[model samples]
Target: MANHDQVLDASGLNCPLPILRAKKALSAMESGKILRIIATDPGSVKDFDSFAKQTGNPLLESGEEGGKFFFLIQKA
Candidate 1:
């Protein structure tokens, strides 16, 4: 929740969309900037985790709140 550099609300979006949108958002950010992603798809938890590892980005924090899955990804 700390002043994210960008916010991507992928709620109600399925599989690849959430990850794809996240990638686009992260691509637009400077290194070390954070992208706050709010997704409804449960697959995003694992998808984003793998994405961070594969892309060399960092998953700072991830959790759920009020039926929404949230991820804080830092561009690296």
Candidate 2:
């Protein structure tokens, strides 16, 4: 079983890897929980934004820091 909150580090991974990992993580989480994802792929920004919109999961936050893209997704 996964914890209520989790952080997934996907830095250095390319497209689809980060999103795929996020999807898997979200699948393991309960409703209302949050998942933090760290990705280095530039495409992840747009991919995750669209994923969140399409999946109906709330995107709590998205930004870049220390040359990495970070996303906080709340499971609905």
Best by TM-score: 1
Per-residue lDDT of model 2, residues 1-76, tens digit only = 2233889999999988998999999999999999999999999999999999999998889888899998999999
TM-score of each: 0.95, 0.92
* Predicted structure with the largest lDDT when compared to the true one: 1
Which residue pairs in candidate 2 collide?
none
Give lDDT per model, in order.
0.93, 0.90
What C-alpha lDDT does candidate 1 achieve relative to the native structure? Answer: 0.93
Clashes of 1: 0
CA RMSD per model (angstroms): 0.9, 3.9
CA lDDT of 20 in candidate 1? 92
What is residue 34's positional error in candidate 1, in angstroms?
0.3
Give me the displacement of residue 34 in model 2, in angstroms.
0.4
